[model samples]
Target chain A: MTVLVFLDPRHPEGRIADAAAPALLATDLGATRGDGVFESMLAVGGQPRKMGAHLDRLAASAHTLELDSPDRGAWERAVATALSEHLLRAGTGEAVVKLLLTRGAEGSDAPTAWVSVSPVPAGARERSSQGLAVVLLDRGYDSTLAERAPWLLLGAKTLSYAVNMAALRYAKANGADDAIFTSSDGKVLEGPTSTVILAVEEDGVKTLLTPELESGILPGTTQRALFDAAEAAGWALGYGPLEPVHLMEADAVWLVSSIRLLAPVTSIDGTPISSSPALTEELTALLHEAL
Target chain B: MTVLVFLDPRHPEGRIADAAAPALLATDLGATRGDGVFESMLAVGGQPRKMGAHLDRLAASAHTLELDSPDRGAWERAVATALSEHLLRAGTGEAVVKLLLTRGAEGSDAPTAWVSVSPVPAGARERSSQGLAVVLLDRGYDSTLAERAPWLLLGAKTLSYAVNMAALRYAKANGADDAIFTSSDGKVLEGPTSTVILAVEEDGVKTLLTPELESGILPGTTQRALFDAAEAAGWALGYGPLEPVHLMEADAVWLVSSIRLLAPVTSIDGTPISSSPALTEELTALLHEAL
Candidate 1:
């Protein structure tokens, strides 16, 4: 079951809509041209987490697409409406709160903004605990292309995700559970739907490393929160124009996202890789505390 | 006014739905991930044009996405239902018939397939006659990347067209009417929503040229039909690994697509280019006869 709320100017607190019923016009550009932006965050105990980061990214995405956005307050109220409904009916163990805004029906300038709250998929949590067998896939863009080609919308989390979904399908078909995307120039970028993080220890100093933001990967909110938490716990942090070799040489690698939180990678392209359970437990605890 | 007919197994003719009302689930993958395929064809005198080519391409797109498509018969019936309704209300003027197939709502195997019929945008025909001022934009992939990376879905006409739409927006923002995409390696690619065609005449013999299929552009149904008619009319035809220089040097250049037909290019990047009214008239006649 899911709950939906629409950000309507006439309804300052949002208009709760029936999710089981049809809720989008067939001509909505979001369904037609994929002309939209979205954010998905985790909700615990009826409260959304890292909403500031998600909303910031959503605004940036809307700006990139040149779509008008409902102000942050409208989104906050709508999300609250949806989450409160979710808790009422589902008693939220954990829910996925999705904020979606689309350039409305074709030929219309009004943007359609909505909030949807649903239970987190069971498979996501299962994979989080069971770990993932991963493969590296080419994202077909040179890292430097982002700076030169803003029209590509590389930094925006737009609704145009067919290639991302295709990459994940390709990975699953190849016997891998997930994929890490590499830039055409051979730099480690991010995963199909998450950020790639690697940990290392040298001279008894621990460090967390993620691909540099310049590589055109979506800045992971969960990853950002965990990095801050790790820093406070006295762990060093690094960003990279990282290569696959760094991942292969690291003490451990993980894919982190809002809902999945952190999923350790146990293998790469069928080759066994080190998985640090202790590090996973430590980071998971840290992430929980941060949330 | 618009008409929508959904292809459902229980309804051999289609399930007609109100286009004015909400008709798609918010969680539909087409709305969220753009995980789908679509074809847009023109309707003349209430009959869809080039439907065979469009349906073939739609099936190919569905296959590439690993989506289960409703059979050709189902699509045919749904399109008929939509067109019949369109003719009733719109009086058989030119219309656009769009076939859409989505991966359905999340966690569901069902595919959402529908046909929408609406009057053709007046601007499409106006621009076809006025010609377009086009700007070139980088598509951010090497020309050769298509074959090596099936995950890019380069050849498939999927619904994830945000980049394509953005390129057009960029062109319009920069004072051009439309955009022509160029690969990272400087090879001339297709236009944002159409295919590029150039004409060269020497010694009274005419040759039609377009970028080769291997460049991973969507195969243009109008371009293909025009090529067949032109070949039958004794014009030479050529496939190209074309560069921007080829477009500049050609006697005439046009962008061709199903709904907009053939639209000539008057200038590229603000530089006046050659345009041949005689060739445009002759080709337009041929395209009409072919259709």
Candidate 2:
């Protein structure tokens, strides 16, 4: 079951809508032109995780797309209403909450903002625990393109995710569970929907490394939180224009996102890569504490 | 006013739906992920123009996205039903018909296919007549990237058009009426939503030219029809890896699409270019006759 709430002007707390019914006009630009922004998060016992970070990223995405969205307070109220309704209908164990804001129906200026809370996918947790087999796919753009062409909306998490979806499908088709996109110039970027992280231990000093934000990847909220926690706990950090060889040489590599948290990558292109269970356990504990 | 017809298994002739009401589930991947294919065409006197070409392109787009859609006959029936209903409610004059097929709701294998008929935008004809002030924007991909990376879906007309919409918005915000995209390697590409066309007059021989399909541009149906008509009328034709200089030196330049037919480009980046009213008039007549 799912619960939905729409941010409406008349209802400052939001208007509850039937999830089973048709609720979007066919001509909405979100559906037609994919002119929208979205964020997915996890909730435990009615408490949303990293909501402030998610809301910040969402606002940045909306600003990138120039979409007029409801303020953070409006979103917070809607999210609270949806979560309360969802907890009443379903148990409060764990739920996946999504925030969406579209440019609205064609020729209309009003934006469509909504909150939805639903049960997390059945196998997502298991898959994240088991680790992922990934393939490197060409993203067809160089790393420097994002800075030169802002119209591409490279860093924004817009709803135009067909290429990302296609990459994941292509990976699955090729016997891999997920995809890590690489720039045309052979730089390791990020996964289709997650940020890529590499853990390096040299001379007993541990460092967490991720591709720089200038590489045009979506800034991962969970990754940011984990980095903060790691930094505070005396772990070194590094950002790169890294290559695939770095992943091959790393002690551990992970694909991190909001709902999945951190999914370790066990292999690349059918080749086994080193992964440290001890590090995963320690980082997972650190992430839990950070949250 | 608009008319909608859904391609349904139980209704071979298509099931008509209320266009005013919300007709799409909020969880539909078309709205969420923009995972879908669509084609828009012009209908005059209840007759859809270039339907065969539109259906052909739509099928290709579905193939690229691996979306299982209704067959051509079902789409034809839906289009017919929608146009007939639109004529009854509105008039027998010009209408804009759109065919859409989405990968349905999340977690479902079923596809949602529909036909919608509505009045064309009021200013479309006026804008086509007055021509366009265009700004050239970088597309951030090399021309050869399409062949190297099929996952980019560069040639397919998917619903993930946020970047295209953003490009047009950027152009408008920068005081231009429309945008023409150029490849990262400095090759002339098509417009955001239309195909670019140029006419050259040299040594008393008039030639119509458009960027080569290998440059990763959508093959314009109207441009193809005009090319055939021009050939029949003894005008020469050329395909291009054309540059900006060619557009500037050409006798006439146009942005062609199914609905707009042919729209001339009066200037590029604020500098007036060579534009011939006689060539536009001649080519417009050829296009109309071909249609």
Error of 1 at A270 (Å): 1.6
| Predictions in order: lDDT | 0.92, 0.91
Per-residue CA lDDT of model 1 for B1-291, tens digit only, reads 889999999999999999989999999999999999999999999888899999999999999999999999999999998899888888979999999999999878999999999998877677667889999999888889989888889999998989989998998899998999998899999998999999999999999999998998999999999999999999999998999999999999999998888899999999989999899999999999999
TM-score of chain B of 2: 0.98
Runs in model 2 with CA error above 4 Å?
none
Residue-by-residue lDDT tens digits, candidate 1, A99-151: 99999998788999999999998787775668899999888889988888888
Question: Which portions of model 1 miss their true places by more than 4 Å?
Answer: none
Listed in order, each prediction's TM-score against the native is: 0.99, 0.98
Per-residue error at A168 for model 1, in Å? Answer: 0.9
RMSD for all candidates, in order, please: 1.0, 1.1
> Model 2, range B1-291, lDDT digits (tens) per residue?
888898999999999988778888888899888889899999999999989999999999999899998999999999999998998999997999999888898877899899989998888877777889999999977898888778888889999999999999999999988999999889999999999999999998999999998888888888899999999999999998999999999999999888888888999999999888888889889988888
